[model samples]
Target: MAEVSLQNLEKVYPNGFQAIYDLNLDIANGEFLVLVGPSGCGKSTALRMVAGLETITSGTLTIAGEPMNDVEPKDRNVAMVFQNYALYPHLDVARNIGFALRLSGMPKAEIETKVGEAARILELESLLHNKPAQLSGGQRQRVAMGRAIVRDPAVFLMDEPLSNLDAKLRVQMRAEIARLHRRLAATTLYVTHDQVEAMTMGDRVAVIRDGVLQQTDEPSALYDSPDNVFVAGFIGAPAMNLRRGHLRSVDGDWTIQLGHNRLPLADSVLTERPALAGYDGAELVVGIRPEAMEDASLSDNNAPRIVVDAELTEALGSDMLVHFYLDAAAVDTGDPDVLDDLEDAALMIARVDPRSPVRSGSRIELTVDTKRFHFFDPKTNLAIRS
Candidate 1:
């Protein structure tokens, strides 16, 4: 295992199009770091650059402690598993896994030992004799991974390796890959557009947009404390509910006015994010996660309640998601990939206990966890915090 570092990395195409800009990243030894973003965000380009598959127009890239800018892909000691699996269709699993070693002229006995070890680790021993066409999608993907593992590379690079599988298979493979990484403890850089996959599998996640890095941190930190509106909105599943609200500070008390409703801001919120005071008497964006809002009927007495007309309801076993319209403007969050049902600009969703009996066309009360509310500067689209 080896640490990888990218300092001020930049990539520009032959046609003068800049694909990446001043990217700096570090992956610790034996760490699994995931790069995630929408399509054309330069995540793939970044990975290729690290693998020596793409040239670095500017900046420095180091693998372990050696400068690798001029090194060839084969000498980088990095193995890449592509989205298409890239297995040899005519070759059996055993041959496919040991192909690299054979090409390097390793002894046949050594290749077999290495391939057998990888097959056992990936639970593909039963399918070793099967050809690429004979194996399942998951088995083929495991073979692709086995090919990389057989090399025993210092760093592993995977670009959307699970994208070809169905949702259920993808879920199952995700667990397998995570387990494999733990067993090998190899440094890995995985690329994906799915936030859920990034959240569940990564030791730390890096969010990129338009060829520039947005934020990188542990998944929980990215959710609990997003650096910007783009990261906050892009990293969550249901996504945080963002709306423009007018900030008001009246007689030492703070409140946000959204249309006809005036919700008090908890004093602790201001104490933690002292920058919130700067937005007094101005418009700022307010972000509330769906899980942070619940049925008022089931909430404690001190929770702040808001009355809204329920537009629709989606029951998902453990809880119900009640969609309602707020009297405020919706934020775009600057990511073109996010498409929602905010046609009229006031879509809000709340995750509530299913027993609360809230239904469409009925007026329902939702209690917000005010202390956990997020505030952002409208001008900069950045979170307001100390």
Candidate 2:
């Protein structure tokens, strides 16, 4: 029901450790915005500042068109759901959900009605009498959400609320939370380290790194057209295959010298990124998504082809992942999660048809979709797009 804005937001401790720097963002009313980044990337710190839990070193925080930099956490009208359920073990679900209402000195009857409504919405009416210790992890999380819902806060702040659950439970809870958001239409700012969760949940996602904002865009835009090397490597499932390549313009045609192979660049590739023409005969970074490369045997299009020795193949029902090494140096995009040793630094994965008979140590041909290839400046690590 309210919009949140952070302009020039900054958080610096007395010890001179700056966790966030000159951050700026605008969350529209009834919009779900996710702040996603690696661990220790200051995402949680930014959220705490907006909730009035952390003092702003220098910046402006606004909610509902009113300044909130000096407002107390309780006065900000924001309900935060932490990773831990943080429910009282002795109190049953009903009392826990209505605790805030009771503290506000609301009538006992009114508290009961509000608690009942939240319980119905969260599908916890049957377990109203059960204590926190008796509920499952998912149930306990729902109790936390119900508690926040009864307050009818102006903004909902959730910090990795699904991290404690199992993978299956996490998936289930993701849908549940998204459904709840749709029904309530409350302004929400969700913070998480998981890229998949951010892509699936948020209307728009903000990627942060080293306490600086990277790119904010829809899931598809982030996946298809990353603004920089870091964003390109961080957003995908099997992170993008980025390697050093030399661009060459022979007569009127263009080609990329990728290690031992020479792949023809399509005309549309240059049409889409006219800036690539400037990098002729120069070294640049090349990025290819797993799906952009397919088994040459299965495809009929006359796309550019490359031969490689398949180091491994993983059969994943619908598609097979072929891991191979291109005879090129891999570009490090500063993602701590990518642990590529020297021997495996140039490893590339291709999502191909599962029916293909590609095995380890076998030579296979792959058709690369030249039009879908991404190019980045080697020095700046930025995408070469017009």
For every candidate, C-alpha RMSD to the true structure in Å:
1.2, 1.2
- The residue-by-residue lDDT of candidate 1 on 213-277, one tens digit each, is 99999999999999999998898878798889998999999998877789998889889988888
Off by over 4 Å in 2: 339-345
Error at 16, model 1, angstroms: 0.7
| Model 2 lDDT, residue 311, Cα | 93
Model 2 Cα lDDT, one tens digit per residue, 161-180:
99999999999999999999
| Candidate 2 worst ten-residue window by lDDT | 337-346
Q: Give candidate 1's error at residue 315 in angstroms.
A: 0.9
Where is model 1 poorest over a 10-residue stretch in terms of lDDT? 337-346
Model 2 TM-score is: 0.98
Candidate 2 lDDT: 0.93
